[model samples]
Target: MSEPHPASVPLLEVAGLRVSAGSRMLVKDFALTLARGERVGLIGESGSGKSVTAAALTGLLPEELQICGTVRLDGVHYNLVGASDRQMSRIRGQRTGMVFQEPLSALNPLMRVGRQVAEALTQHGTLSGHAAAARSVELLASVQLPDPAEAARAYPHQLSGGQRQRVMLAMALANDPDLLICDEPTTALDVSVQHQMLQLISDGVARRGSGLLFITHDLAVAASICDRILVMRDGVLVEQGATADVFTRPQHDYTRGLLAASDLDATDSSGRLFTVSSAAGYVPAAARKRVPAAEPAVPDVPNSTVSESARPDDGAHSDIRDAEPLIRVSGLNRTYRRGRSSLFRAPSEVHALRDVSFEVAAGQRFGIVGESGSGKSTLLRILAGLDQPTSGSVQVAGNEVAGSRENELLELRRQLQIVFQDPMGSLNPRMRVRDLIAEPLLLPGEPVAARHHAGRVAEMLNAVGLPPDAAERFPHQFSGGQRQRIAIARALICEPRILVADEPVSALDVSVRAQVLNLLADLVDKYRLTLVFVSHDLGVVKHLCDTVAVMHQGRIVESGPTGQVYAAPEHEYTQRLVASSLSLQPGSSLPT
Candidate 1:
């Protein structure tokens, strides 16, 4: 037996690897290699074999899936595919470490944060007892966590999303593994937090002299982290090259479509935006019927209840300087008292919103941008009537929102509807699609029959580009983007005067994100509904909103027209947000 030369063998390598589930191939002829201290990114849309490839490498795939070909990822030259359970167990924490997409699901619920990290180091025949505990605290501190001692004692749920992600990073590098696989780690984070986390990952990998396999749908993020890139589509490698060349001059149509769909900084002034058709394809789908460029901007949809009559005099695309305001918030304040329920602790009030004010005119697209715990959610909750303000004057459509009676509240609910960020969380798993969308119309005092509900539901399905037969399926059966469309359909069932969207497209993939955004823009134009959107991505805000307000801490730090505020940010926090967000422009360097 001859050992491979250390100078020639790469730290990570996959040759002709293929993964399949029954007769369906998930990944075919996948080949990748990473030298020491190299960062390689695998980019693709959902169901494009990125996660499956990662699973195959890490031995995380379920038993039903069949894996073939060669995979050489080792800390001590051990085989990965057919290793014994005990041998595989030893390889996981000691040889290669993995950071999963969702920290809450990955981290143990009943364990302390420090114990989780310590177990990785101790169970793998390394540090133990006080030594492990000390190293765990050191790892947390190295990740720039505040008050490392307190964080070590806190449970997984006690930490914020960014904090939990940092903990995962600390654990991944615990034993100083030779290779690391991070799967969509920052997919759910705000721009500020996402930039910081990416920096932390890069720093950690560099400190350990480890190779990284970064998998994500974000192209700009890939450019920032990975030196090399692989583009996958429909279980095959469409293109592979250096990050710069691939991004600036992609050869494959699939790669081009992904790039066009993910360009958030794109706008009308930046040239005609590259748009992917409704049908799924790298190139334009053969069945797609595009409208002439000269026609009105609004898309034509058959069997849609939304029409010219549904729209107000002011359209979404028109300049709304002369339009009347629909929502007004003046000096709003919301305070929450902590430790009030405990007899031994003195109650301390936390100001969630302080003197916040903004206005949304009829048919105006208004965006509220902020990071987590920046009071954006608090302001949105108050507007949705889910929370009461401590002191403020809030008015919607000439109706006072503060201290309304039950009947008045019901009326307000009908006039204003809200769509949440997580589509699956907002939908009912047990209910059929038709019944779920019809729930709003079935409210008391409405004279609607079963036949009418079915008709209205079918019409909305057609409008959202879903099939009529989809009504028979449950929410769990649909994809994440489809569930979001269903959520949007439910919000529009009653034809509400105002639509409040809270990060509606953040959870979707690049292509699905474009589709959903186009749908929202069309709905706003056709129905003339005022939109109040909350997001952390400034590029998204600039594209969809005419005006934007930057929220920091508990106050409105900056507010102006979208282009003005974005182009010349005055506040420090606002400027940082714009700088940290990924760019759509070519040759753009990622945040460090």
Candidate 2:
């Protein structure tokens, strides 16, 4: 993935690294040495110590975590481990730069983007006044942000996810540090934006001759961006080699499982997607010789119109071909009024959804694929009865929802449920898992007996592949995948006929994403529910959806059978989106 660098003169070196949180060890004796202009990828699942290792290297770990490591930069003579705040502060932006996962949280919401970049410049007294401001815009332009000057004046919330990420890159490269550490910086970005961001990071590192440490759970992304790949699991490095060697010939079982799980093309003879599970000993589907168990332990819930035997084996919805659409939308439009331009001027209108219309038949898996700000979310919210459309007709289960009041949405709400993108944000941290799942059942002016609530919660937990005891825990106590399962359980507790999943697996690791996708597929099939899945990942949509609608700007640019659309996209935007979707094969060429 990169040209060989001279090893005799390494750019940065770390040895005898270990991080501990009180009695539990987070990272154990991790060591690495990077040459100039080298890009190394640290690949791992959530809670596998990948982020912790980056934090330890960058002096960003929490104060309570005990760190014992020897970090030597190209020009630094002192050990970076246990350095005082003053010394570390000087080294942070001047010598080494960090790009965190969530740029929204990392950036100041109140500050203008350009001012933030300028602050990064003046932190080390490198530039000030107009010079710093000019340099900030220059940095933004270097990251390929459209209209850099205008973007500089906008606040972080005003910009899209990709734009905010570009701002983070601009600030990270403000001083051209010798070492750049990026922690899942493109995890939540869409395919095109992620590709652009990766290219920007690569270009920035190359131009500055910096050693790069890119930490992420995405194996294909690592394969594309990094020269060397290091596989980590449970706080231990399992494999390390060149990009081609590690991915093509994985020696470790965990690495092999990760590769298998990431291969969206691979499936069993029965068309069931192959998924890996560390809790089950990290075995691939080929080794196991069986597909994931589609039949969950819980029995079917109420309001199921179709039986499990009527479900399609290959994700086809042939049985619902003659049925009326479960969800119908016509000329859907959502426009938000911005604040007044001036004291007396009229407000600007942001058209989030422009004449969007789609239909999902009962027992069909319908997918919506698009980048951010493409009206996918707005459409989902309208379908879920959470947001009203501006000028359109939205009918779910034969009931109009666009102009319905809160009192008129009881039956619609009972028929439709939503699973959000970020489960951690949606799930109440203070509530127990049981109560969280059962809360939907205890609707307004309706109270169920404690025994019935417990029974329903346990049944949902089993259906989603969670243990019964998990109901006793809180949201914070589970892994990312487990948290999503809990969210799924809650969404299904009432057994809604229509399921609206908004990027449910976008933020998860590859393995966990596979597990969740499989779980969703199985549950959707077994329960014969109508699924309206929204995602930016084209590959995931292609894998899970029988029908797909390609949205761009606020309208559906293309719509057809998933295979037909993916095989031959008609719209220019859909064609570009397909081209930008990243998929890496063994021994395949990577971007340089």
Candidate 3:
């Protein structure tokens, strides 16, 4: 009924943590232990109740949701699970600090970043103006912000995603709480930044002698940060063991499947990616871990410039040299002015993309890989007709992008589609799934009939492996992976010649990522659609893209087949990128 207490009380303890709605249970019988200065990882997929468990520990769960548990932070002697709002307000950041996944949303946009962090300190303790300000700068510096003084003056919007996350970490550690809970903190970050962020968190916690409860869907990240791991599925703890044992010798089927899905080497002996079989509510068996059941028919990276019809099995390495390019760019450049300047000083310009040149062939899976601010999104936006470059010759679907008429631009848009990084931002929550998917089907003068759109929406839902009933529900009702599928379906309804995905799977659960990747590949092959994928994930890019282009400091540093570039990177930046890829596997370490 109760956990075995250590001689010196554990830093945090949970017993019979249960979160439930009127009838549905989100989390059940969840229990965990964390000692001071110890790091633990709670690993699960979306809807596995990992987040809910964290929320319960912090007493942040909604009022409507019923919570029953005993959450105790040693020496505090208060029940965190049943704590009132008044009690939780004092306890939350003071005794148990937390870092959420999205830093921008967590931070107030109008407030200066320094004030926001200082406010966290002022809440639990007393520190006046200059002292708090100085402390804020010190905290930012501790998290490795480039210029702590300048960063303290900047707002949340001014900082990069990675920097914002670092600020969040700083804010969480402001009070030096005994327990630190980080929920998917590095999910949206680039691998290089993610590694640094993890290090920052670890070092910060270690210095404070704080216990850590890291919740994440990424097994490798969990492995890298945590000493112990708890595997959860559908709200129940399937297994609990040391990190090394759980990662390598997982006994639970779900844990094994998760590992298999997260495997960078998720391939058959012949080198073809496995095609996941998805049924209605499909759960992969343990046997499916190593065996490649299906050789996904994909266009292999060509050895030489030739034609479109060549395959890897054919042993003839030919590329689409003679074929008409779907999207072409030459000497592309995009510059932005960040802040206003006085008459005495000139305004600074941020050159996002400089002299970037690349050609995407028809039906080719072209991947653009880079770190943040490396012009990956800028290049993708230019390709999608969303943004313009000052100096470049860009032709989309054989139409000049720079000098296109309104109707001509609309035509180009119809020929090309884009799926943004956050699907929730793109999809309207008020609309039904059918309406969201059918929004693209409506034309300027000719509105598609509701009945016709409904039929099409149902078909698209099925195509993405969602149930037909999902069409009736709202976007909020669906899980993240399902919402992404809906976003993909919406992008496809227009039947664009090209599909542009910007870090599509970066925010998804590892197991769900594989399914979505499989679905994307299937759709690309089925419709013979050219894919322009932009991401920091080299492994994901190499898995899906036939060719890859590496971007660094607003320039094309490397361009070649994914295999070749990964194997032998010519540029210094690219070599660093390849070397800095943070993985659970051996031979990789976070940047110091």
What's the TM-score of every candidate structure? 0.89, 0.88, 0.84
Q: Write the per-residue lDDT of candidate 1 for residues 394-508, one digit (tens) a residue.
A: 8888777777756677777887898899988888899899988988888678656545689899988988889999999999999988999999999998999999999998888
Clashes of each: 0, 0, 1
lDDT values, one for every candidate: 0.80, 0.83, 0.80
Q: What is the TM-score (0 to 1) of candidate 1?
A: 0.89
Output the lDDT of residue 449, model 2. Answer: 52
lDDT of 2 at 148: 97
Structure candidate 3, residue pairs in collision: 306-319
**Sort by lDDT, top down from the best:** 2, 1, 3
**Where's the lowest-lDDT run of ten residues in candidate 2?**
302-311
**Top-scoring candidate (lDDT):** 2
Clashing pairs in 1: none
